[model samples]
Target: MRIPTVLLLACIPATAFAQQAQPETGSEWEVSSGVEYESGDYGTGTGTDIEILSVPSRLGMTIGRVQMIAAIPYHRIEGPSDVIPGNVLGLPLLPQPQPEADSVTRNGWGDLELGATYALPVKAVNFSLSGSIKLPTAENDLGTGETDYTIGAEVSKAISDKIIPFASFSYTLPGSPEGISLQDRYAVTGGMATWLGRKTQLSASYRYGENPDAAVTDDQRVQLGLNQWVGSGLSIGVYGSAGLSKGAPDQSVGLRIGFALD
Candidate 1:
């Protein structure tokens, strides 16, 4: 099935809301909300302008070495046509022209995701394994309209009292749409984080992904982020990413707010 460009942009994993590599000490609940904005030209040589705005919220609970999270997102997409140049993989090739009337602006709930993670501490490093499912819950071509699954692993180590480095890899099994066949994709991430102060942290990461299908090239992106603890059990963060290849968005920005219930 041909994937929607908006879904590709919305689904690309970012570290904006990722959990710590190591499980927390005790049972805790976290609630988080965030918004993102992205705009780019994605239609082959047509220079078709595409803009996306997304608001996402997640609820998570952790106990010992296990964690579970549920998330929902709202999406608003504006573009020249419902059908874009590339398949679901967000590869910009050549634009197929539709009637001007076919262009539209649409907004709605995108998809629901449920995931679980487990962590193990070995010597000086933490190893984590996670799995997730994306449910089709969108309308107006806002989502893939199919269920997707992903499995991932991560490892992290603290080099110093304030610095931690990590690496992760994941594979996604794509769901088939009515008339299109989808292929599996994989991603890799490497990054480091350091404490700047008692209540502030800074991080940078690079991500690379194999194309989801034969229609697109692979994707590469770099992200920089800062998180600050504003009060007890509450924190806020901001992040930005720049695309390093044609398969990624040109640029994107986002903000997040989170609260933890101890």
Candidate 2:
């Protein structure tokens, strides 16, 4: 049976809302679109595969000292379970069996986030506010699933004209009562942005998060990208991410394209 949009959204839980997958560019009234893929194991057992094709748009304008910003993210995910050896095997000498991912399902548009940011007026230092929600708009066949409403805030500071740094943290109130995927979560990250020279800009950030109610799948994410300006409003980049932990995937790589307008 095809999953309903509302039910699919409901299946995606608080965990989606709590992850810091995107970075703040703080460009006034600019929009960008990109595709991302990530592979990681579930808990310390299941192999996990996730692919996201997101077209995120941000609009920010400076008002005297503060920069007010708004953003939205839309995407999907597909996950499969893992298999291991069973504990007791005697008749025919065998190892063991453990299944992490019990089943598999494709969650389409599992979640969406809408939020606004306010940047403080400081010559070299800036602060921002981010408010958003994650719709359970994807398939939830993975067993650990729930609906959720989330809110978050973060800030960024620039060390020089060509360099910027930022950090973020947030809390969520899950709607599902069945003790869904992961748990209420906490996230922390820091990154730097710099110009390679003339028209190239490079940005990278390292993100870490913990599952508050469960210790099964804590995460450590590292991301890097190189942007080259082709014309007045056109740009492209090679982007990738990898998980650095026991239950995480080895690597994930993708591409990005963006344009700007007056």
Score every model by TM-score. 0.83, 0.64
Over 113-215, each residue of candidate 1 has an lDDT whose tens digit, in order, gives 8888776555556676888888877666666677888888877677777787777788888787765545788888888877798667777889888766456
After superposition on all C-alphas, the RMSD of every candidate to the true structure, in Å, is 6.7, 11.4
Give the alpha carbon lDDT tens digit for every residue of 1-262 in model 2. Answer: 1111111011111111111112234432334555555444434453433333434344444333233334343434444331211000000000122454444433333333344444343344444454555444333331123344545555555556666565666565544434333346666666765668656767677767664335455557787766667766566666666777643345666665555543
Worst 10 residues of 1 by lDDT: 1-10
Which candidate number would show the highest TM-score if scored against the true structure?
Answer: 1
The best candidate by lDDT is 1
What does the lDDT come to for candidate 2? 0.42
Clashes of 1: 4
Clashes of each: 4, 17
What is candidate 1's local distance difference test score?
0.64
What's the lDDT for all of these models?
Answer: 0.64, 0.42
